[model samples]
Target: MDIRDLLLELARTYDEGKGTSSGVHAQDLLRRAGEEWRHLLPAGFDAEGNGGSGGASRTPWIGVYDPDITRDPKKGLYLAYIFAADLSTVTLTLQQGVTSLQAKLGEGEKRRRYLQSRAKQLRAGLAKDLVEGWDARPDFKCDVLRARSYEAGSVAARTYDTAAMPTEISLREDLWHMAEVLQHAAAVERNLRDEMASSGLPVTKRVEGEEEEHAGLDGFRPKDGSDYYVLIRQRKIKKSRSHEVLVRLFGEYIEERGFVPITKKMHPKDIVLRRDGVEWMVEAKTVKRGNPTKAVREALGQLYEYSHFLYEEQGKGEPFLLALFTEDIKAYAPYLEKRGIASVWKTVEGWAGSPMAVAWGMVDEQ
Candidate 1:
């Protein structure tokens, strides 16, 4: 297996693949990733998660998780391979933090001790070439978060320099590191007070929908999700499964029409759409129950920027807004139209295409 080849495939196919023409959907991602690594990954440990805005990002990555251990990476460590925009480089990371960790490992000295011991051991090994030459320290990677409401705290990480090592070294370390790094983390997850996670090993089945909170993120928000835009950009976290699902569904809609999607082509829009000499962009936002208004409203601004900055200014394509919802948001349709953008949502009647969609000539089917 060529490391460069893998990086190319990750950056290209995952970042801008065939199914991605319409947009990258969750199933497309899962299928693509599951196929790519099923041969390499452990039976229960699947490589998943379409990183950063789903369509693509400067730092797009796919996370490998042992579902039996803990799906939420913040609670425990998951292997993540991140690719650069050009697909010319990559970074293999250990997904870690307090919320996801607490969900699996719980709180107090014992948990901290284990993490520190493992962290120290990793540091010690890297020093002696037990692992490849890489900066394995929290000091360099920690981001000092600004949460005015709470005490200022930090999250650190060491940026991976993909150019530093021989191909064999990076490839060998990736496999070796994945198997070794999370074994202890997975084993001790049973110590968590949550009954479902009390068993320290993989399970015969999987459960859906666990209520988790990001205290760090919420601290900066004004309870009404008012500071959503300000706080969201500052969040350096993993993509939600729901977001992936929405992308997948939207991707399907695009594929059926045989339209190819150019993802993250413009920074503001998640994916750019084109057909019949009519080109446009769509910025998708998943609806969070309490913050539907905020999510849709912010999406309007993002769509406008993608169009105005990347299209209109440069004499290019049109821009549109997409709000993915598991429930009805027809009431917000007029709001989107008022902003001069098309609104899209799901319904029992199939995709709820707003009047703006027909008016803008974006969805030919509409």
Candidate 2:
């Protein structure tokens, strides 16, 4: 049966008026279903708790099901169980600690004394539970299975003897299940964050790049031959310092476009595209990822700097294009537009075409 069907059946069996089965609600039924069919679920948190400001801290707990059961063909047989924690118990623990701490602090500055005493008691209680709980429960055999320990944020693996069960499961299989669970949880968290943001909650924004307006040059003939000189200067600097991959890509693109691409290794200005005695200076930048990191900002700034040099030194009166090549356009497009920087946001498919290019026009002084 499908997951939904199986869940419904479990819920019906556990319904209030059901026979010997406990009258658990649908949600609880679903939570315990993983344990009932432990052989079919992935491993992870059995219970997750998110606390509100007024309540106590809830510790998340997870259940691991035996992976040897082969009853279900669709989902194998192993499933890890998860359930939500009760908030009342968490609140009580917090209240108890607070009361004890306050009473001790009132008599003297016994902060360390109170903390040490409380910790000792807590550890003792946990140890007592571990010894008694495992020993008393026949179903909880330590020989076949071991409880996994977690350090800080890292999870240690719990392994069970597959040969002990009817089916032979491996440690690798258990690890794979654990990894899957973590990945799924992460996706869920991201979805929750997106939902919260969409619900008009205040979100933090991290701005990494300078916010400045830039303009591209339009058709305007330079009075002097200084524009050519500046272009030469910037090109030289760019060729010397730019990545080899970028340099090769730029050269190939220029050649394919049938434009004379000149590289000056001195104090160069812009990448000049000359055709039919007309020149279009393009300030180019290569963006690998979409996120606006320092490197991305620096590349953009370099592009703008080259544009400035072209307008001031070169006699080319055409609009300068701030051509950017990147796989991720959504993240960087708005920022580029906000800064009044003309950009070409392109994927692999559109990079060879001019339609993907966006140009921010510059004002010409008459």
**Predicted model with the maximum lDDT:** 1
* lDDT by residue for model 2 (1-366), tens: 322343234323322232222243443444454444332222211211111123221222223322122122122111222111221110001001122333424323243333333333322333242223211111112121111101111211232222222121333233233433333222222222111245333232222333332233333344445654443433323221223334444555556656676656323433555667765555444332123354357656765655555554454354444444432445565566565544443332223223223221121111
Candidate 2's TM-score reads 0.29
Model 2's number of clashes is 35
Question: Candidate 1, residues 10-110: lDDT per residue as tens digits?
Answer: 54455443333334553255346645654344323456645443443444556667554457645555665655555455556554544434454445443
Lowest lDDT 10-mer window, candidate 2?
A: 87-96
Q: Look at candidate 1 and tell me the lDDT of residue 253.
A: 68
lDDT for model 2, please: 0.33
Each candidate: what lDDT?
A: 0.48, 0.33
